[model samples]
Target: MFSTVENYWIKGTPKEQLMDCLTAYKKENLLTLAENQLMPMKKSHTKSKIATALAEQLRHNFKITVDQLTETERHILTAYASGNLPEELTEPQQAAQATLVAIGYVYLFKENQQITPIVPKELAEQLLENESEKDTDNWFLTTKTTVETIYGRCELSHLVTAWNQHASQPITMSEAAKFV
Candidate 1:
């Protein structure tokens, strides 16, 4: 019974808080009523009901049903087994919100790391300057073509042709830069 309750508890809010919210929502129901009017009626299987039904399903499907649990135990077991518990309370309890908030911050930290600032073109240029010959050639060709294309100049084609020729016979950066 303790294991069943603990599993259903979900390591978050107290059962009382959820019960309160469910009770309040059931009473007021102004927004939910309007929304539910548009939505189709759900199958209306409670967690406990579903759990009991699942045991029946297991018996039918697998030809087996465990006999340890009583009717009340079956109801509680079904509810817990389905990993469902009711929100019978009002506004979310502080402890529940705190747990969720902590989870939110973990996600926030990951997002912050992924949101890198755009590296300036000048930085790319500087990085490429000290690289190997092949890297330097690729960088120069890419940078030259990008710059010319963005400026709507027809010189990019000429620059690529010059680069291909220079690759066949090595040339200094100044010499290659002049051709491009």
Candidate 2:
């Protein structure tokens, strides 16, 4: 049974699909992935067993799971989650994506002459859900009100951008300056 990841992999819940993709991996590869980077789990046999176990565990602890990835990989995943990443990746983006694949958070799917980076739907859902939990609009509104009280109704697009930069990432002062 040979099939690409984006294909059948059972159009089910994100977790189910992720389990399918992990199951598709050869046993050796899955073993390497589990041991080397993506997760820490009890020893196990059988493809479906390991995948199912990891998926269930990951669903509740996605933030912890993501912490296992590198900073660039986490940034790429977050960028994707926030709907801000470009469709075409740059060199560094490609390298980060390759690392994601190796860590089992992403897959490269080729079809019709294009290679697309595919984060497991399960992981994407979790990441986007976490991002939405930020209550960003409420925070922005509070900041906007405070600024208007002090400055008497100035434009705030720049302020909004500043808030977004500070809120979306945990960057140092210098790194924040670079974005500006």
Candidate 3:
């Protein structure tokens, strides 16, 4: 997750500049600096919280270009901000959505075994205001399938393979009976 944001950060500035920005932010907030670098103390901190704070500070204070998100990611974020994504998603869409969740742009909630996306209030507001000039409806929608079925199929396949691999190694009835 940090890798994704780090890539974006490095693209826009030198490593030293990034570290300096984090250091200044940490000092301004009275937060301890991370070991060997300039990140704030991360104990008990969520990645989304850290990323959002860092990104906001970098953009607002340093005028750093931090949002290097792909067009697909941007659209997914937009839909998430507008609360317009379909309730269910296809495997590929889910994977992409998972990336968004991982990168701190969105969040997920599980209720009654169903997972849903929840966009952060501040992020949604910023995106809406910043992207207002663009035509968001041009974003494409794709078909979706539930994650449970995908996991089920994957587990079934692995079980079948394991069973086939060990099928020839028979255990004696006495050994089986010992466990029983």
Q: Give lDDT per model, in order.
A: 0.33, 0.61, 0.45
User: For model 1, how does the per-residue alpha-carbon lDDT over 82-174 read when each residue is reduced to its tens digit?
Assistant: 334334312333233222212110000112223111112322232233234546567666777787778866454566565667666555545
Query: What does candidate 3's lDDT look like per residue over 1-180, in tens digits?
Result: 333312222112212222233332323132322221255555567544554556565335221121566656677778877879776666666566656644444545444655456555656666776574222211110001222355532333433344345655444434333322
Error of 2 at 92 (Å): 2.0
Name the best candidate (by TM-score). 2
| Model 2 TM-score on a 0 to 1 scale | 0.57
* Candidate 2: 10-residue stretch with minimal lDDT: 1-10
CA RMSD of all predictions: 23.7, 9.7, 19.4
lDDT of 2 by residue, 16-72 (tens): 257766776666566666764546655567777677766565556667768677777
**Clashing residue pairs in candidate 3 (N, C-alpha, C atoms within 3 angstroms):** 89-144, 89-145, 90-144, 90-145
* Among all candidates shown, the one with the greatest lDDT: 2
Give the winner by TM-score: 1 or 3. 3
Mark the 10 consecutive residues where model 1 has the least summed lDDT: 101-110
Model 3 per-residue lDDT at 7 = 27
User: Per the 3 Å backbone cut-off, how many clashing residue pairs does candidate 2 have?
Assistant: 0
